[model samples]
Target: MSKRGGSRNPSSERARGRDREERREREREREREREREREKRERERETEREREREREREREIEREREIESEREREREREREREREREGERGREGERHWKNRREGHDGEKSGVCVCACTRERERERERERERERERERERERERERERGRERE
Candidate 1:
């Protein structure tokens, strides 16, 4: 009877051990699934961050292109202004040459000389201001380039 009872006891103990092992296996599978989900979420977050960074870079590039266009326009305006001044000077010289050589001493010639002197002084001042503006623009360009590099 004692031997029979001991044999029954081992069989029940083995059944309980198998049930515990199965539960442990199920828990391990759940843990593995959780780990996979966490990794997936982390990868997704990283991908989003990369996309945001690219977007910021594109925006900055667009701004830089716009700024460059504006600078080009400003330079064109400056060139046009200088050309107009040169044209005015040339026209005046031509007028003076024609008037003095072809015509007799005229009142118009006196007025023209006085006007030319005043215009020359004003032109000198404008040229100085233009030079200052050019210097300032060059400095601004250098600074912008540096800022773009940093950003």
Candidate 2:
């Protein structure tokens, strides 16, 4: 009876030791799975952060492009305005030149008319004096007419 009881105690101890080792192996596998899950989560978060940063950079680039385009348009408009103003000033100068030419022509024509009137008056006075001398010399003696004409 003592030998049987001792053999039974050793068999029961061996079974408990096998069960403990199996339990330990299962726990290790569970820990490994949890670690893998944690690593995957960290990788997913990093990828999302990178994508967000890229999106922000793209938006900033677009804003800069828009601002540059607006500045170019404003500069072009100012240049056009200056060109128009110069054209207007040139036109005004031309008009003033034309007006001055017209005034000079009018002054020359008035001077020519006054010179013609003076020439006509001098010719009429010479004709009237020649007629009066012919009337005073009617039927005079030859020698006396010659003396009076000379005096």
Candidate 3:
């Protein structure tokens, strides 16, 4: 004779335990999947940040190169202007040498003309100096802007 509801069935108890374990394992797997997804998102975000940083660096390098090119152009222009001034000086000297063979009155007139020409050249040189100063100021301003960008 068995007790009516006092004894538990062993098979039923084992099946319930197995079902609980399966549910717990499924929950653990879901947690692991969520963690993997989070890690993947973080990796993607880091990659994007690196790419953006690289792009910005490239742009900065390009700007620096452009500034250098502009400075080179300015130097070239100054050199050309100096060469032109030297050629003019050579021409004036040649003229003076020829004037030595002429009469006194003609030589005096040539000297006066040379003096006037020197004064005109001095005035032109002063104007060019002012222009060069302005350009230098502009370059300095650009450098300041680049430094600000760097900062």
- lDDT per model, in order? 0.83, 0.74, 0.85
lDDT (tens digit, per residue) of candidate 1 on 8-127: 577888999999999999999999999999999999999999999999999999999999999999999998888788873576566654444223654344334446666888999999
Q: Sort by lDDT, best first.
A: 3, 1, 2
> Ten residues in a row with the worst lDDT in model 1?
101-110
Q: What is the lDDT of candidate 3?
A: 0.85
Best lDDT goes to which candidate? Answer: 3
TM-score of each: 0.55, 0.51, 0.55
lDDT per residue as tens, model 2, 1-151: 3676455577878999999999999999999999999999999999999999999999999999999999999999998887788762565444433444234546422222233345766678877877777666663566687899999
User: Per-residue lDDT tens digits of candidate 3, residues 1-151?
Assistant: 7767888889998999999999999999999999999999999999999999999999999999999999999999998888788773576566654544445555433343456567888999999999999999999999999999999
TM-score of 3: 0.55
TM-score of 1: 0.55
Q: How accurate is candidate 2 locally (lDDT)?
A: 0.74
